[model samples]
Target: MTEIPMGPELLSPGQSCLATVEQLLDFDFDIPAFQRPYDWSDKQVSELIDDLSDAQRKEVHLFLGLVVVCTQSNGRFAIVDGQQRLTTLMLAIGALGGTGKILRPKGGGVSSLWISPRHADIGFAKALVSTSSETEQTLSQRRLKQAFSKLSDQKALNLATLLGAQLIVYVAPSLAGATGLFERINLRGKDVSQFDLVKNKLIEWAAVEKDSIVRGEIEDFITARYDTLYRRLDPSSKEEPFDSDKLLRVHWILFTQKQFKSSDKVLTEVDSAIDETYSSKKSIARWIESYLDSLVRVAETWVAVERPYEATPPSWAPQLKHALLDFARLGRDGELQPLMVAAIIRWQADATDLVRFCEITSFRSALAKKNSNHGRSYKWRVARQLYQGTWSDALKQPISLAADAVHQLFWANTPYWSQGEAREFGEDLTLEQVGAEVFPDNALDSTRFYKDYRHLIHYFFWKYGVYLQHSKEWADFTRIDISPFQDSVWFGNEERFKGWDIEHIYPQTPADRDTREGRAHLKVMTQWVDHLGNLTVLPVPDNRGMQNLPFIEKLAWLREQKKVPFNELLATPDYRGNLLNKPHWGINNCKRRITEIRTAAAKLWGFDAVRELGVGPYDNRLESYQEDIEEEGGDVPDNSAETVAA
Candidate 1:
């Protein structure tokens, strides 16, 4: 390849106009394989023409002379440079012809000197000639025809008119020696970063399937629900559609580094692995989709209830990147599934305040030192603190404290002891009250309490199940229902026999059946059935046909339907036991069962079953339990209480 000095030349209207369609047609200007695809829309093309016209009216020398490099090909000139400009000129020539001006030979023998119709540029040039008439046929036709006539009649025209009139100075180099020159020219004054190029190239390749539908499906699936994993760092100035670079990095961490194989590895490799994967887009889309699906499933357990939005701020790009990596690692290690299942359990039991639970847990995890084993322990401690204290104060603690609490709860089983117990345990801690000092009577206050306290309730539930035996005295006195049987059915055995299927006193199919009367009836029946005042475990077969039947008729139907003598069946241990042992006609049965289970649960959590814990009837009561500890000279709860004493 050779470099020759081409002076600053202008495309003057009346000058020799040496740049012919022949030279342009034969040139082979190189575009790199990694460059972004042609993305100019029609409007952008129109803008370019307007700019050129404005420059021409101002008489500013906006149009520059074409640079042509000649490549030897069997004695004919093949342009090894400036194809875009050459091709565009052919488009302009074709546009001129569309105005009905007959293009004739320009300077005598010059027409014969132009390249023949068989040239590659001829096809593109012809397409342009057919379409340029749409611009302005009346005023510019004469000048356009003159321009067109300057090229040979034997030359072929382009199909589409190239809109932008920017001059491209071509550099023709020998086929054997142009790679380095091409690379250098392409890189000149270009701001396309290596990382951006790699990412763009990968997305382009992925978009190239023969079936557009398949390509679109892949793109849609990849981009749908992974803002956490691949969100743009700064959307204000972005030119690309999405954060493919960040997504690529996530893919690398998950698939390349195998960071999802273990929690420790996830903890260790997540950051560096993401960094390494940031640039290349070649395998990114597929990799990202797979990685994100796995990550979400794992995070379902590890994240607290409110975390989907709160754990990583939407606009905080760096943290979001790290968070996704962490998710990938957690998934690989098989540690996140159980945690997600636990979160699901909490969500199902009482969806009242899961947001606070998620937020507090996230705060606990983020605040801990990188790779700290104590992080899980610290998180539980933070949750316990939030439960026992005031809401406003809990929100004020550093986010790190909350993160540490989450780490402790999940990984270490750290106990959150009462203030007094915390002092005895002698662990470093932060304690504060939570909630509004002057409680409001509105629903917001109630919601806040539920939101703030649900995490602790979930923790308790996970540790002790639904059993609350330690509170037997309080439960029995209050007539609480806490039976293990989720549903009940009623059957009878008097003069007229009938039966009743209690169903899920809560009516699992609330949406399936709809009628005001039906709903009202269900509501009343469920209230009666689910209450501690009414519930009975009867034979499943006898209860099958008992739809809304009365007591005496139901009894007769039950005897007939079940094919058993009423007195003999009633005399059985199960039937006699219910009638004689608990005299309130099975009302006491439900109350007794609930009281017993609640008492057991209370004892399991180390509270006295008989005492009131000084809590109000409607209050969370757990909060009152916290207050009781404070009155008894405790400092506040911490992680040490998490473990059961040997």
Candidate 2:
């Protein structure tokens, strides 16, 4: 790795150099790997020049440096960096030919360098230039030629001449060493992405046979399809920096092999399996070739339909890609037939329309065999077959494939039972039994099953609710006081006893103190009273009238209202000893009662009563309010009597 600095003299226009196009194209000089493509529009470029001119007229020297790498071929240079500067300079030069152009010189012609357009850099350079024309210019051989011809004919050749005359500092190094140097220099700066590396590799490998058609198609597919998936999965991190190698590895996994499984299994456990099967470069290359061939076949089929090339492809491409990967994983697991069926269902059916088809089929297949060891045995068998490819022949028959795969899952796993005796000694059940039974074993297993099938459960419950809205089973619930001590319960529902707002509970204003001392005392009091357990939802009218009342006064009011069998209930051993024996008896009793109510509510909801009894899920009545809002049409009224009762 050596750097040879070129002198300050600029090269003359129209001078030929021993430059091969490949030297200039070998690396991306302007945009870094992770950076988005060049997006500066003509308007932006024009504005930039206007700013530069304004600065120049103000006598501010804009220092711009050029860095170029000389190629092995003499007089030839590959732009290692600073292509943005060079490109912009050329665009400004071209605009100077038009007098009204913002980037044009104050005086046109000679001063503007509008010289002969037969400059050597024209052919290799036009792609990076943009003009204020309607026609979209793409970087291609034909476009380059056309642009060069127009510049020459219009005698706007000064642009290229001026660029050629700019001071260029050159550093020459061997290609192998240049890569290491490039990586080091870019390590802390704008870096290349893994996708770029893969794309470059594909292009280079295909270039030998001029077979870029497939490569181009794949690039377009990734840009339009897979990129959206990445964005969806990590929206906030979408623009975060990425390593080129990591992205290439991800692309290889998705595109090349069906080695990874899609079992709704978390990645933590499956990562080891992935490393064992598809981690090698050689394995990835083989997989890529096979997958590419399959895609080529699909593309050919696409071309045969309707107006062929003129017709756009089906919108199922993304789904097909995901399904294909899933199918491959299933095949690897030896569950080929079942996976084949799943693939067909995925291909032919709309997931929304055929909601339970896949799950039902999979469930039915598992129920076919009664042996307790069947499910585990089948999984093992599938794993073996994946490596052996024994079931590869049956993949084409989609229905048989699905049925057989599902059958294996059903028979291999044991059916769950409600009682120990039933679990240990139950007879073999049919698919219907497997689906409908809610045995003790099933209940026990539901925890694990729910973990795996949570998404499906949520979907079905939501959909079922939507469907049942018009059914007789859908009933609007009204709050009713069922307690024996109705007066006390009602009193507790009002501000006189329970509707103590935190702010008033610990009043900031001291009865006879200076404002600052009163505020300090209030802050400490507020901290203690602001707890959720201290707060209670109550009737707003009652709350307004009871603000800042003393605990003794509130207790007396409650007694007068007969809200509680106050003397007896408060005197009971359990209540007096456990709840009322605190230093702060009123607050402590209130907290204990709140806990009891929350536990009861949680039990009614079929949630863990003890787990939710504190000032947590059970005490948070917001969900109940939300459920009410969902059931009825309007939002829950802030001061509704029902809300106060809860």
Candidate 3:
């Protein structure tokens, strides 16, 4: 009989079949030398045996997964997809000796069933088939032996069942056919990710151009860089690893503000999007070149999150590292990632201010959308504009971005405070405090300032710390000098207060009283519970201890017991002198204290510099605050006289 041609034609339809143990051993399986080394751990080995045993008990035909083999010109079968399974099966049979012999070609020189590539694992695989002893067995060999270790009681039946198990054996006639089949499986198979599909689509497009060189280059680049990119992402999740597709989509959105919901859309629409601005091959090539560059850089930025800044950072390093770390941790969920990436890339040399600017912008956006997540469409529009415009423009007109983006953010709903009531009462405040020129109309409604709790707390502490250090009031309240409370406290290193939280100055709960007086105390607690005036940042552990303490006892603890800077600030006469005389901690004192704190914030946040700095004529950005007048049936409270000592 004439033999079939040694090419893809040999893999014609209906050429596939199942093989028994005896037939499979006679077939001369050759593990391709180019394949990756055995990486299946012990768990996989055990699972295969357990599954096979269960199939046998149920009396069902066990269909192991697919195995693709190429018929070589020399008539040997080259194992493709099921190398792990096939290799494990041989080891299992070797462990169970009575069934049949695993053979090598007959000069009897290489008597093993498997031919492994020359590597550390090759010797290990050889030892598994050649010996029955467990002594000095490699990890893989040990796992293989363990799978069949208990089956020594019924070696013949178990080995027969596993070897004869049916698998869909795909026989490709030639090497090229096998490769094409493998590539298709990896690209469109069940485990395929959007990244894999998108990559395949890109190469397919290149292939359409009949540019084998370009196609080959692209494939090579993907094969080489795929693992490196995945290693950069969070490893805990197995469902979706580092989403390269999302990364590319973000870059695309930055440039076009267009959303691609699936891998198909990315490939189908990306070229048209490029064509809108550039129709020539040269322009398309340049665009792809830049896109690839951004991908590489963004990957580096993502990985940089796991590490700390170098000991000696550049002038701008602190803010950049802080922003990168924050994004690495919290900022990933937001729409501002592209902007964050842009800042990192642009200001890398002196990225301090730019990173800070991005952090502020991102946090501000987060605060703006506190009730809901920022939508991709919103971020898309902003990112597109930022990309089309210059980075300098973004830095120069932060307020414009703030105002425009905020207006766009809550375009559908009326503005109001998110959760908290205004601590500083104001309706007609001009933004001139930061200076009139800096803002459009140079007026920011200070009433909305307290709504962004985190930004406010950070700004207050940093500014207050700097001011205290300069005025020789770091420890002492007045000209009566005292030793510095703590030398150079800075939020620059957050680990210094890793366990700290924003502590309420007035305890959220009043002491429990059972009598009529106790009931009255409880009422006061309820009235002032979450009041803005009552809060300050302190160590979480210290705050826990202070909770449930009586008002006066808390005061004494702050003054005499706690070394916490903010707690000490509250204990100072300038801050609590008015409250000191009050017989009880009531709603009145909380309101008045809130007013004093607001005044301090105004100074720290440049309320006085507004006019000189051309800062704002911006209104408070809270939906709750916007309805304050209608909700209360009165104008927002007037704390005009509640100014602090500036």
- What's the alpha carbon RMSD for model 2? 20.7
lDDT of each: 0.31, 0.31, 0.47
Supply candidate 2's per-residue lDDT for 353. Answer: 15
TM-score of candidate 2 on Cα atoms, chains taken together: 0.31
What shift in Å separates residue 263 of candidate 1 from its native position after superposition? Answer: 25
Give the 10-residue window scoring lowest on summed lDDT in candidate 1. 487-496
Candidate with better TM-score, 1 vs 2: 2
lDDT of 2 by residue, 520-606 (tens): 544544433533223332234544555554434443433343221222133333433364422223445545543433333223221
lDDT of 3 by residue, 1-646 (tens): 1132334344443267554544455565776644433445657765776787787888776777667786755666777567777776776776667323653545746544543422434555555565544453233334444544544444435666766676666786544455556667765545644554444344334333345566545544543444344434423211123455666666555444333232334554655645553545544334444555555555665334333322123444554665454433332334556654444454363444433433333343343443223343333444444444421122244423433343333332222221111112233434453332222111122323334344445444544444554544334652312432331232223232344566655455455555576577666656455556555665455567776665667777656644445456655555555654243455555556555554543443322422222222334432222322222112222212221101
Off by over 4 Å in 3: 1-192, 209-214, 234-245, 255-268, 271-290, 302-316, 323-333, 349-351, 361-513, 536-547, 551-564, 568-570, 577-646
Tell me model 3's lDDT, rounded to 2 decimals: 0.47
Clash totals, every prediction: 89, 28, 38
- Identify the runs in model 2 with alpha carbons over 4 angstroms from their true place: 1-188, 204-251, 254-472, 475-646
